[model samples]
Target: MSLTSEERAYIRSQSLARLATIGPNGPQVRPVGFVLNDDDTLDIGGPKLRESQKYRNARAHAEVALVIDDMAPADDPIAAGWGRGVEIRGRAELLTLDAPPMAPDFFSNDVIRVHPSRVISWHIAPEGQARDIV
Candidate 1:
């Protein structure tokens, strides 16, 4: 299913996200700390991080995919059986300077901003399919 405004907003509000990029070797995955900008751009910050392979890969390819989800089980086991998740497809761009200030401990390096092209939401069904709920 497609994403609703609320689901997209929830995905942006998340603090932790998994970024997927195309590296010289192959596809690379990393857990990143990010902030959602008012303009719908995702700001990722880290020290020395800007020079990392992920950064280089993004610069070369630009295309990226991100996933954010709540992993904790709900108070009710039945409710917990259903999983909630958000996925974003977008192009990543390197932010050189004048970026917003993040917490000192937020990300140790430079920031990579991702502008989403598509957003989708998912839930675990009783039959166990990761069904798109939105």
Candidate 2:
């Protein structure tokens, strides 16, 4: 399924995301920079991607989770609540693609495309309730 406008916009506004993978020792989570591809798959790249533990872990286990979120600026200083974000759980695969022009010099351009099976979003509703998409 395609992403909602809100979802797409949220992704575009963020630069960092948490990538979760299963390592040989156990579960591993790392901060990663990604681009939201036209096809809706996240293109994640880094230096030495082929040799990275995350890549190895993805090759061994496809299951993964990616979280993109941040605290929304509070209009009312006294207002308190939870932060807003999206969590994508799905299978991942490695892809070797031409690097985006904006990619850092250290990036290798190899990326992991996550095929989301489920998406959970919080604070997107008018009532601030979490819901599943796709």
- Per-candidate TM-score against the hidden true structure: 0.75, 0.87
The 0-to-1 C-alpha lDDT of every candidate, in the order given, reads 0.71, 0.81
TM-score of 1: 0.75
User: How many Å off is the CA of 128 in candidate 1?
Assistant: 16
Q: Tens digits of per-residue lDDT for model 1 on 34-64?
A: 7776676777766677778889999999999
Q: Candidate 1: which pairs clash?
A: 2-134, 46-107, 46-108, 46-109, 46-110, 47-108, 47-109
Clashes of 1: 7
The top-ranked prediction according to TM-score is 2
Runs in model 1 lying further than 4 Å from the true structure: 1-3, 76-79, 99-101, 105-109, 124-134
